[model samples]
Target: MSQRKRSIITASLLATTLLAASPALLAGNHSSHHGDNQHDMTEMCDNMREGKGHFNKADRQEKMAEQREAMANRLKLSDEQREIWSEMHEEKRQQHEKRMGKWQKKMDERCAQSQK
Candidate 1:
């Protein structure tokens, strides 16, 4: 299970890196004279975004369950451990959401400022 988890994490990281690198690839092709290529790029971006959203939803659910199980097993945990884990998990989750929200707001402001 640990190996599987590591593999999933590695794969997710690789996918994220590849996705981030894609804009460079697209940008490199800007000298292309083909109009259809632009349309294809737009379609690819839309499809990739939709696919990523679905993948993230499913991946997050699976990771949460796996994390709980792994923590329980590694800790030789009891019911009390489970309760404590839940509290810790919720706290971490809320913190992450808050951080992400702030990050998103900052990014939006930067984008808006750049546009202006």
Candidate 2:
């Protein structure tokens, strides 16, 4: 074969080989990433159940306090306005807790039923 023809044939073979290997390579890459994510999520859940998650209750409360202080400062609330804001915040927190409690109970019941 001529040099030009030989070069074209070699390039064609290389391209075909890569195209044939691409799907398996992509699939493996995807599964590896997915597996890592799944493992991380499982570890997070286990840590949370053990009260050791990234943002446990104290961390969350501290963050909320910081946010509240920032908001109060940003809004330049007066003492009375701050009191009102506190009251509203507490009311909303209670409502959220109640709603979450109901949701948790429902989920627990569903889990129990599924185990039967």
RMSD of each: 17.2, 7.0
Q: Write the per-residue lDDT of candidate 2 for residues 1-116, one digit (tens) a residue.
A: 89999999999999999999998887654667877875675565556456575537678768887899899999999999999999998899889789977966775575455446
Question: Residue-wise lDDT of candidate 1 within 37-69, one digit each (tens)?
Answer: 666655545544475653265687688879888
Best by TM-score: 2
Residue 87 in candidate 2 has what lDDT? 96
lDDT score, candidate 2: 0.78
lDDT of 1 at 107: 53
TM-score of each: 0.44, 0.54
Clashing pairs in 2: none
Separate clash counts for every candidate: 0, 0
Instruction: Give stretches of model 1 more than 4 Å off.
Output: 1-58, 107-116
**TM-score of candidate 1 versus the correct structure, residues matched by position:** 0.44
The residue pairs in collision within model 1 are: none
